[model samples]
Target: MSLSLVHSRALLGLEARPVCVEVHLANGLPSFTLVGLAETEVKEARERVRSAIQNTGLEFPANKRITVNLAPADLPKDSGRFDLPIALGILAASGQLDARKLAGYEFAGELSLGGDLRPVRGALAMSLALAHLANDGAMPRDKPGMPARQPKLVLPEGSAQEAALVPDAEIYRAHHLLDVVRQFLPGDTPPEVLDGWTRIAPIPRREQADYPDLADVKGQAAARRALEIAAAGGHSVLMMGAPGSGKSMLAQRFAGLLPAMTTEEALESAAVASLGGRFALENWAVRPTCAPHHTASAVALVGGGSPPRPGEISLAHRGVLFLDELPEFPRAALEALREPLESGTITISRAAQRAEFPARFQLVAAMNPCPCGYLGSSLRACRCSPDQVSRYQGKLSGPLLDRIDLHVEVGALAADELVNTPPGEASASIRGRVVQARERAIARQGSTNQALEGQAIDAQCQLDDAAAKFLNTAATRLGWSGRSIHRCLKVARTIADLAGAATVQVTHVAEAVQYRRALKAAH
Candidate 1:
């Protein structure tokens, strides 16, 4: 056989698009060439593949003109993930292995000069893409008439295990190029001791995941309540406080107040982590908490690159994104969050292509009340002038503030008060109420209160006559925008859920109103 084809995948955002490696050896001046929109990293695979094959005692087509093309020329190909496939294709084309045996199997891995296979990124994403294709009747058939068998994924040990996490996925782990060669060699007999290759099974972690307990923080009842409400409704929160008021501590423990993840949620979260090359078996089924520093660029907060990758918010999908010292973040970065916060997704558009990443993360942000951190504090005087305070608070635009549903004040606890205060309620107890409230919201509307839209909000949050009048008067007096009023109603609906009330009452409306005014500058 003078021509051979091998299959692989390329990471484009979360979707793993297919790529075909075609190798041809013909009589001409000895040369090596790789084409089809390959980046420098991929073009370098030619050297790695050649070295690996030669080092493994295989015949390299040194005297023949060799050319490799990653088909579908428009798709941008990067990384050394195609190295293994290119090597296999070359060997098969040069008559060293059985080219026909490569059918029904896909390969992805980087190769060392010693022929050792190195893991690639987006293994789980590729596996999930295969599953999606199969379910959607789009998985390509190896041959038109043969009975279909599940596609086998050949990857490095690390990536093989990650791919096996997908249900019903067939994964084979190969430690070296020689291991893969032995499988597809031109023979029906199996190797006597194929120690380097084995099938991997999905290993779902059985143990319960643990997080920081909310009981560690004391004497911030209002802030704790707000965290519970935010967790229940999937609402973003802003905490304003003087220094040493435990805003960060509360935010850190906020994830523990949410319900446990479903299997679907866990798989989606782990798949995203795998795409970012940050997936770990221990972190499986555990909700993530991403806390990027205030100095992070807007591109880092939201995803953007030559080939788009997930940012902090997407990595925190189905989890929490805590931005401590919120006002200290770059204005551009802060503003970039507005769209994703509302839409639960982010679309990054480059000149050549556009990619969308899921970013349905709960936001927990905290900031000092003033530039001096003691504007309304009874313990210490604020040193900044009014203009300084105004400017510092003005860094967060009104539109951005409007997106945050809960704004709570966290006051500093006196020494005596801190010493005398008992351990506050544990997260387990608070999470019980939160989970129940969340269930009520999901049962009634099929989503969290925060996700309710135009007509859905008006239908689910049917305010009684008294509650309607109170909210109307408050909206008019406070000069609230339609968006703000809707947000307040969502919070009220959450409060009603917590109390197990049938409708949003005046008491619920009043409590929800308090949360909207904790930061005076937000007005």
Candidate 2:
């Protein structure tokens, strides 16, 4: 019997666990078997691997007993990512390729019956995993930087480019199974330069990201200011308004007001996107805005599957998650968001496995005031009864509302007002002030104000005597929870930062209080 092994990765959420594809050939009755894969996947994988070798004019031990096993059987594997590894293992076991040459390389790519290579999902996650593993131990060198010890990652053309996004990663792109076979064929053969096989260069981060101009919205200064405060502090927002009040427009453009993404943030966001098969090279450093429809299920919002993939919230990490017509979303789906909002991470536990994904997204939710969509509108009279309005507004739970840092009312614009009003402030000017405020908060506590907790909250957001009295009195009368009090204090700290103030003042407290009152009737 002859045996060979090839290395690959299996994706579980953002994590990529190492997988070994073992192929063995023995003289016996003609048979082929695959183990460690779901029964549903075995047939397809076997056929693809077999046909790929035969079609590429490579030797296949069809007359002998062939066995293929993916080690670590408990790890759930999905997609065709292992096809290339399995095929290479078969060749090595059949004595068609040198197994020793496969060292220092990890492979992942789907294969066609014709031996053409297909792109695999989560390429960036795999690359990031390899990069992290290379730095797992040992101290840093004193004189020069530690030499990069990452394994060379081999993938299909499109996927290779995605994997190359990781800094200092060695990635090789192959267009066909033959291209890979040529490189690993018996000893000392020179690697020929072919158009089908090449190294992918990591694209540099974009200098600027494009978003819809905030200047289009006209004459809603209060709502605009609330958005500014939310952006400055990385706080969640709830916007209640009548239809066509620019709530949706404002929510869509909100991502532009926050600080630009750092290299680490961009890589993390891209990694999540890559897992979902939604990443694009053009969007390398651009902040994402994930706007799932109201009909989306809890699994779609927070992520759940047999192996547990990342959901919409995770896809929006380091960016915005805009939910328009918030009340229309299922109550269960809406409730699922409460935990990730506080923790900045969502863990999906399944019977088979558990996966956690980063969910540090700025939520921008908009909703109508009532069932008729204009409860307090001057433009049109609301036709829904008071009970109908109450129930509609009550769709949002109190706990969810309390977690939101700012609640602003966006009023409908009159025709004359729409025509007469000039363009509002540009996103660039607002983003500059937001960035300055964020820098101040980071300088003070090394994090965004919204992330403050326990002693950090009190230490970073210290309230003056008058400000403390005002907040205490308001909390008591409003019957707020400790969480609500803390959230308000964080907002107040952000307001103080925006004004370049050394301490929280009564004026900052008062502004924060007005935001919490926007949904008083609904509460």
Candidate 3:
């Protein structure tokens, strides 16, 4: 009997855990068996490996017992990512290929029956894991700290660029089973490095969607100001408006006004996309924007399954998660978001493994004031009664509303104003102010105002006596919780930044107070 081992990775949430693929060939009845807690897809790799070996003009060990095992038997393995490593292990065990050259490398890819390599999900995560493992001196080597022993990664040709995103790691691309074998086998000539596969292109910027600019929304300057504050602070916003009031349009433009993602933020966002198999490494850094329908289930919004995966919130990490008709969403889904909203991460636990995904995203939600969409409209009449309106609005629980920092009423636009107003300030102009505000916040607290807490807010958002007096009185009368109060201070800080003010002035406090007026009054 001969045994061979190769290293690979399995994704558990946004992270990749090391998996060892072990293959043994022994004298027994001709059969193949896959063990060690593999899912059905992984167990089915026997036929694929056999066919891939044959297509590569290699001899399949027929009329002999072939057993493949994925170690750490308790942790369930899913997907065909194990195919490449298993095939390589089988070849090594059969003495057809050498396994010594594979020690420092992590292998990942799906094998097609024709021996071609197919891309697997979570290549970025796998690269990140191997990079960390290399850095930690966990990889096997003669010299424990030798950098050459840094875990090299072999990925499907299509995923090589994505894997290359991890700095300081040598990435190899393989198009087929023969390509991988030739690199590790002594008598076989190594395949030439594939052309145009070494360098990964910079992430492409998303094309600007045709959204209504902030300049187009006329009147309700207060609402616009609230939107500006929300954009500047990265705060969750609730816009209660009547029908035809441009609430959706205003919310859509919010993305354009926000600052662009930093390289680190972009990488983190792209990492989440990689796990979901949505990442195109060539254009990997675009911020995610997810707008799930209100009818979305709790699982669809928060992420859950036998092997939990990311949901819309995780997909929208480091970007916008706009929930239009907010109250119309399933209550369970909305409630499930409360944890991530506060913690900036979501942990989904399955029977086998627990996975945590980043959920740091700016939430922009909109809803009508009432069921009739005209609860307080100036131009139209509301047909729903007070009781019915109350019930409709109550769809959004108070706890959920409490987590939102800014709430502004978007009243109906005057007909003449809608027709006559040219686009106001372009998105670029508004984005400049938002960026300035964000920079100021980052300089003071190392994060945006929305992420500030207790002492951090108190230290950075110190209010003048006049502003303090107004805020204290408003807090009492509005029944603001501690979180609401801190959020108000953060909003005030952002407003002050937007105005280029050095202190949290009374006017900034007053504007922040105005944003909470509708929510307080409704309560």
Candidate 4:
């Protein structure tokens, strides 16, 4: 046989698109060429594939002309993930292995010069795509004409565990080229099993996170209460405080107070990390925490480029995006966040294609009171004038601040309070309350408060007469927008949840109103 076909997958954003690797051997000039919109790394696969085949003690078909093409040429191919498929194609085309048995399997790996398979990124995404195909009736199942067999996924040994996470897919881990051949071809010698050949174990839960305990942060009781509300509702928060006020510390610990990741959330988060090439397979259910520098560009923050890979925000999906020194970030990047903040997803468009990445992250931002960091400090004298303070505060736009549901002020702790531990609640204890609050929100509204929109908030977050009167008075007096009113209701709903109340009381609405008032006064 002079022709062979193997299946592979190409990553487009967080999605995996199927690619057909076709190999053809002909009586023409002795050369090897790769076609179908291959990028530099993919084009260089010819050399890697050739060397890998020869190193495996297999015939490389030196005198024959060989052509390999990735079908669906319009989609750009950009990685060495095609190496295993290309090598298999060459072996089959050279009559060294049977290609007939390779039909239902998808192969992805980077090959070392010695034909050892190296792990590639996005294995989770590829497995997910295959799983979706099977679920959607797109995969061929055993029927009258079709043979009943699950689709096999061949991945690098290091990535087998991640791929195996998907049910209904047979995962085969390959350490070397010969292992692949032995698995598919009859009478072929099986390669030696590697030392770490056992199935990949799911990521272990951390006995304890590195975050600071709420008990350690003295004073700022109101700020801590607001943090609980934000945690319960999955709402974005802004903390304004002078230096050494524990603003950043509170934000860092917010993630620990969040509910544990569900299986679906873990899979979605894992898939996003896989696409970003940062997923640690051993840490399966751990949520991500992204804290990019304030100097990061819009592309770095929101995800954009020539090929359009995910950025910090997308990497923080189902996790936290903590921005310290919030006002220091460039205006453009901060403004670019407005859309994703509202939609819970970011869309990056290139001339060729547009990709959407999930960014349902909790935004936790902290900023100093002024450029000198002592505008409201009890210990330090203010160094900046009114103009400087105004300019510094103005760096954060009103519209952006409006989207943030909770605005907390972390006041400086008293000198005596710093040394005395007041026996505050630990993160686990706070997390228990947060989990209960979230359960109530989910049970009552079918979503988090952050996800509530126009009608949904009205339907679920109904306030009594006194609560409504207080909110209306506050809105009129504070000049709050409709969006701000809705945000306040969401925050109040969260506050009610934290208090273990079935309804939003007058006091809950009053506390939510205070957070907004404090922010308005601070600016």
Position 116, candidate 3: lDDT? 92
Clashes of 4: 3
The sequence of per-residue lDDT tens digits that candidate 2 reaches over residues 1-523 is: 2899999999888899899988899989988888885445534778898899999998878898988888888877888888899999989988888998887789999899999999988999999998888777332333467665678999999999999999988999999999999998887978778888899998887677999989999999999999999999999999999999999899989999988899889999999999888999999989999999999999999998876778999999999999999999999999999999999999998777789999999999999989879888999998989889889888999999999999999999999999999999999999999999999999989999999999999899898999999999999998889989999999999999999998999999989988888778543
Tens-digit lDDT string for candidate 4 (1-523): 8999999999888889999999999987899989999989999998998899899888899898999999999988888999999999988887777787788788999998999999998899898898888777677876765644557888887678788776656787877887787666635556446543333444445554455577767778888888888888999888888888898778777888888887778888889888778887566777788999999999999998756788899999998999999999999999998988999899998888888899999999999888998876788889899889899989989999899888888888778878774756788888888889999989988899889998899988899999999999989999999999999999999989888898899999998888876555755
Error of 3 at 353 (Å): 2.3
Between which residue pairs do clashes occur in model 4? 203-282, 203-283, 203-284
* Model 3 Cα lDDT, one tens digit per residue, 1-523: 2899999988888778889998999998999999999988898898898999998899899877998889877777899999999999988888887777777677988999999999888888887777777677777776654553667788887777777766665787777888788777745575456552243442344544333467766776767778788889889888888878888788767777877766567778878888777887545555566889999999998888868889999989988899999989998999998999999999998766788999998898888888888876779888898788888888889889888989998888787877886666777788788889888888877988889876888898999999999999999988888878888888899999998888999999988888877744543
The predictions' CA RMSDs to the true structure, in order, are: 1.8, 2.2, 2.6, 2.3
Better of 2 and 3 by lDDT: 2
Worst 10 residues of 2 by lDDT: 137-146
C-alpha lDDT values of all predictions: 0.91, 0.91, 0.82, 0.85
Off by over 4 Å in 4: 144-149, 186-212
Q: Write the per-residue lDDT of candidate 1 for residues 1-523, one digit (tens) a residue.
A: 9999999999888888999999999999999999999999999998899999999999999999999999888998888899999999999999989988898899999999999999999999889888888777666665886534567899998999888888888999999999999998888876546779998988876545688999999989999999999999999999999989998889889888889988778878888888777898888888899999999999999988888889999999999999999999999999999999999999999998888889999999999978889988888988888888889998999999999999999999999999999999999999999999999999999999999999999999999999999999999988899999999999999999999998999999999999999777432
* TM-score for each candidate, following the candidate numbering: 0.97, 0.97, 0.93, 0.95
Model 3 regions more than 4 Å off:
136-148, 188-220, 281-283, 520-523
Q: Please identify which of the two predictions, 1 or 2, would achieve the higher lDDT against the true structure.
A: 1
